[model samples]
Target chain A: MSDEVKDPKDVLICRCEEVTLREIEQAIDEGFDTVNDVKRITRAGMGLCQGRSCSKVIARIIAQRTGKNIEELLQNSYRYPVRPEKFKIFDEEESHE
Target chain B: MGMSTAYYLTLQGKRVLILEAGIFGAGASGACDDMILFQSKKPGINLELAFESLELYHALNVDLKHDLGFENYGGMVLIKDQKELEIMEEFVQQQRMYGLDVVMLDEKEMRKRQPHISSRFIASTYSPMDAQIDPFHVMYGFFHVAKNLGLEYRKKTPVVGIEKQGNGDFRITTQSGEVFEATQVVNAAGTWAGEIAAMVGENVPITPKRGQIIITEKIPMVGETNLWSAEYLVSKLRPEVKTEISEEHKALGLGFAFTRSFGGNYLIGSTREYAGFDTRTTMEGVNAIVKQAVSYIPLLKDIHFIRAIAGLRPSTPDGKMILGEHPDVPGFYTASGHEGDGISLAPITGKLLSDMMCGAPSDSRLEELSPVRFAVVKGEQVQ
Candidate 1:
């Protein structure tokens, strides 16, 4: 929203996946209206942070462009393993036959 | 499944209305890997239909005018030991005889192709015909084109009832009390298709088989081709090998499938368990997949997985999809129960079902996949 930011396209919205603002805008223009749709098309919210870092930013962008409410757009589904846990943590016991 | 069916039907100049129980790509279609695998298929109608389906995907990429993220990166089946190697050897030969471009790769050749693979794998099979397409892209591609061609769809509108009138017409009632009347109906609800058929007094025998997959952050390519384990394939092809698997692994229905998405994220999967309709990924399932994957490709342990997701695949008893008109329920059709093969066979299934509806003569081989097979097995009349 600020003109001080030089070339918003070059700015990275999703640091984990390194998706640029331009990529997110392009996905929206291509008719991917929903936040989840944009995430699926462009790898914006599908990284290590799991969209916690960029989903709101992307939702705001969708609202500004599509005139849809940001509240409605931010209804992205959350999955299991709330945080980044190691695979070894879940490997407790193995019963080999 | 519903999207593809709608696309084909609309392309044939028929007015189509899609009643969705949820948003776009909300079910298994959204949560699945982008694999249109060929090597994993059994050597039968399943394999034959996959070849045709691959051809259709190529055409759909052009017809839809959108990048479906179609890629022919090929696939590999890692053979862990001599037992799996022996079984895969015969499997590959049979698939080759059926005109598949598949071959067994010795350890030397396999390592040359996939240097990152662990030394535990003795050999592998390679097929140049194996491919992948983004599920979201494909589903939305069909939807976009079909919508422009007069296909109307309502999201979050679940069908509550389906009744047949005396004059061979269908009355479809939605959960919102909205009623729709059509001359024909297609139960393409995937996992819930059995419930849809039951409304009309037909038994489709579709069960929800849950599969879980984990997604890693963007990483370098692990191998030249998408990967699968002959361990699971062998077990599926020869169920007698179940005794060799551990109880935990058996309960998890563990297998190895690692495919990279167009976005550079490696989607490592999965488990095949009958957990009814629950689509929640468990710690046990995710851990098993991670252990199996790390053991196969040690480099994977360093990658950070971002998310875990689960989907319920509509599995049938015979391990084949039901795709035809219900002989007892006239003017009604069922195109469900693809299990894991739904992504691979979506295009062909839609085309065949639409062709059948339009009175176009279809491949006689499809008769084996008909819903009537269930009835005939029950000693009912053939026609």
Candidate 2:
């Protein structure tokens, strides 16, 4: 009757760029006062889809670590070329074929 | 003067229907590792052309650089095993062949660049030219830009059928029973290209490879760059390598990878399963991914997992994209099967497709990506 993930190992927060709870705590211990610093060191939420999936959990980890509200320190990182179309999909031309 | 190509036709300021069965990025584009990767191409995979596409992306910074969430976030790959080392070597050579500015660093250099890596990880290949992007946001940007440019979009509208008109134009029927006529058509439907193409009496070989991934709660900044176990890339090539055991599927352990997304979250994945439309996650798969990830970054043992999700890569027979119009059909065109390059390759596709529709020539060499190579042409129709 519990919705919580059973195995502590499988209890993932971010889906796109895999990061873990223990690692978040460790980041906090290392004096990472903010979410961006944690991200800079851990490389979480840096994958294809970016952090749309993992940012909140990361904020929670930062909050728990710094005893600071997540909203105060949570930062957003944006990168470009959002879609990596399949190779052949990108260069479709009618001329060569 | 008028542009006859589909993209041009729509932009030439007319009604254009972009049929989506679901929301934006819900298809193959939604289900990708989304690496704006230009360094991982094979020796014969047209690395030069891929770089050119990256350059096109660079030029789009005016629009793409906006909170479209674009960043300089460089790319880095970790070397954990011999098999991966081989692939990295090949990748380095391919990049170097085109006078690319990528460099392979030794263990010390890698550690210098990525201090978050476990002491065990010895080397890395860092390419500043590679960057990351968010898929959904970029698509939204493209949709808005296209719409502003006068393109009509039909969301939640799936094109169930297409009929060849006696004239050069074609009839496209939507699942909603809405029928439309156009002189030109483009199939950018991602994984459904095979079935979508069948509507026009053509064949597009597309395989839907599902990549399952899991993220953890925010981990400390472990690495400034993306850390990938070359082993997974090698395993993608040679699936017989020995990896940890998994209970769900035999391939889970070997199919694992770790990458830092642009949002400061860790992405652990991914098992490449052939399960059609089955996007569910499994314990065995998650275990395998965690095990492999910890081997390089021992700190993950303390972190918690967030969730598991899958993205479908529009894999093609040739590991290349199928672009341009049909060789045989006058109006039907294709822009699908980008295995994992959908996010990285979109800007390039938009411009090229636009140029093709305008009957204007592209500065980039695309002889290798012509869509007609995959299909046989029949008779021509008058426009």
Best by TM-score: 1
Candidate 2 segments exceeding 4 Å error: A1-97, B1-15, B43-46, B81-87, B236-250, B253-257, B362-364, B376-383
Give DockQ per model, in order: 0.42, 0.02
The window of 10 residues in a row where model 1 chain B has the poorest summed lDDT is B374-383
Per-residue lDDT value at B271 in model 2 = 74
Model 1 / residue B334 / CA error / Å: 0.6
Give one digit per residue, the lDDT tens place, for model 2 in B1-383. 00112334455564666766765456755555546766566644445556665776566556533344565556777777666676678768766786666788888888887776777666778888677665555654455455656766555678898888787778888888999988877888777888888777787888877777776555566766665666556655656866434445454434545556545556677776676766556555555566666656665656666555666777888999888777778767787777767777776676677667667765555767887677654553311
Interface RMSD of 2: 16.3
lDDT of 1 by residue, B181-273 (tens): 999999998998878888887888888888999988778887798889898889888888643678899888898998989788888999999
Residue B43 of model 2 has an lDDT of 47
> Which 10-residue window in model 2 chain B sums to the lowest lDDT?
B1-10
Q: TM-scores of the models, in the given order?
A: 0.90, 0.72
